[model samples]
Target: MPDNDSIDPTEVARPSSSRRDPEWLRARLDDWLPTVTGSPATITRLEIPSANGMSSETIVLDAAWEDTDHRLVVRVAPTPDSDPVFPTYDLDRQFRLIEHVASTTDVPLPTLYWSEPDPRPLGAPFFLMGRVDGVIPPDVMPYTFGSWLTEVSDDDRRTVAGTTIETLAMIHSAPVPEELLDLPGPGETPLRAHVRRLREFYAWASQGRAGSPLIERGFSWVDEHLPVESDPVLTWGDARIGNIIYQDLSPVAILDWEMAAHGPRELDVAWLIFLHRFFQDLAEMAGLPGLPEFLRRDDVADAYARSSGHEPRDLDFYITYAALIHAVVMYRIQSRAIHFGQAEEPVDTDDMILHRATLEAMLAGAYWAGVR
Candidate 1:
């Protein structure tokens, strides 16, 4: 594993600075918690995590309600001034989806409290849930660089990877809520609709700016090689071990519902596989071992097959699609970084994507052959 000093700061994604003031948020919560809890409440402590997401803002607070101390989390939609990552954030929809999933499925999730959709109290729509305490694979240092995940025994790491696949099985098996469908319009397959949305997002992200030729070609490739449609299921759009909160190598709370949608099982499966490879590639580029054996594509496919009793097919298409999806998001993120003056505009727009080489290799059908 690479030491902290050896890791280039610019290579990692930086967390966005807080848009709302801490005391201001505490005051608002003090005034607002009573209305929802039906009792007077006082905020004892409040903090915005340094590891807060680049998209939505996360507020962690300890409050006294009815003489009981509550450790809670607030998922707040980004204010308009913050230059949000996605075009829109539907906190209410996400809250309702979590509620439905919790009620119907055994998939572990944080205990949801209340969703404030009005955006009047907190300067944006926000939802509250019980705080889950556990380890999450660090994205800043790229977990593979050095973390509990890298320090664990191979057996323990295997348990973590296997159980995460089982969690994916559980999530896919859950009954889909109508609102979560995100169904395609007439005559469009779910996979096509998914790629269509990605195109639209890329357009929005790169509007009025120099767009990526690589991303444009990726879109074209996706259109030419769209696969035979499979029955749609609820896919955790941002599927990866990093999104999961784990204790003792077991997932306790599966978080981050912002990207939840209905799509083929392979969408989630490929994402889980590709994301780890993304980080693993970063580690190798830095001349580190980086858990090469972890989340192997074949191992992930076989594990999902055994867990779900449904074999994954057309992975070449889906995995490439996953890389395409990630490239767009990374482009948006880098765009945001440039907007914030944290990074300078590169001579080539493709330089904005941290994994440009990986995506290019995947496009050329040369990536997997070199994986082993």
Candidate 2:
């Protein structure tokens, strides 16, 4: 595995268990270049970021095309035998969704060139898009580091933070194309849809094993307080700092859209705040200037409400919902690694520590929700 800080972005692939090595990926690119572009292409170097968690094998490839050097990103899904918990949606849909936003809004994002849904190409679904240059610090990778304030000047960090929030707002505000998204039937509430889908995720995780008490508690709270909310907004499921690329202390592009869907406007806000909380203590950290000094959760909710017609109330319920969703997601990832054989086992001693800490947080969150 190449060190993210030291690696030549052109020469390495993310060494996660799911993705292929640089050699294998290079060979594939060499084989496909002529078919797609009608010209020979050579992948001079391949490097993958290590942050994507069961979402996709995202990589950056530096290649030469007709004597011109270019950087391209490939988003590839895991192998089928390595069954995933949530049925993966089409990358073309994600590409078109983001592309649609770019066409309509001022949201900065990587341009999409092509998307191949059939696994016949790489033994899994893959898509190619223009690469944006930036460095994602490890501290910014997990939401828990939200408090490890950036060394960059406040103005620059705010620019990065503002770009993310603004882009999300743009995505939330953009008129969703019905044909581009596989939405639920007409008149369905997005909140209900999320709850139902999450329940299904838990069911899959607990198929042969006993359910986690933490999950049961969280699920009960979520079911009882189901928002029954409806809003015409595009919700990016895994909206977090890690997904956005920062260049010169500003976000150049918003990266992952694999879990995007149509949902209540608050869902996106709650998800963003939840993600921020995982990294920073909102009460202590000043998220983005020109915004309130309070937790970004409040700022995000207020910002979205002010921009859109709908406002987010019962913030606790939504926050709890976010925690539950992430808890379940993390647990499922561990379950996949531990039982499903989809992920490579961790040799690091801290793996178990992190898992325990995650569960503790989940359970504590569930406990608090019940108390509330």
Which model scores highest in lDDT? 1
Give the number of the best model, judged by TM-score: 1
lDDT of 2 by residue, 72-181 (tens): 89888777565564555576777778888889887778978777877876877788888887766443233233333355555665566666676677777778777776
List candidate 2 segments past 4 Å from native: 1-15, 137-149, 154-159, 185-187, 228-230, 281-295, 306-310, 340-372
Tens-digit lDDT string for candidate 1 (1-372): 112223353454654553679989988888898999898898988998767257888889898888899999999998888888899889899899888888888899999999999989988999999999999998878899999999999999999999999999989888988675678879988888888888889999999999999999999888898888667888888998889999999999999988888789999999999999988988887888899999999999999999999899999999999999999998998888888887778889987777788888888988888886
The true-versus-predicted C-alpha distance at residue 104 of model 1, in Å, is 1.5
RMSD of each: 2.4, 7.1
Which sections of candidate 1 miss by over 4 Å? 1-12, 15-18
- Model 1: per-residue Cα lDDT at residue 101: 83
Question: What lDDT score goes with residue 218 in model 1?
Answer: 90
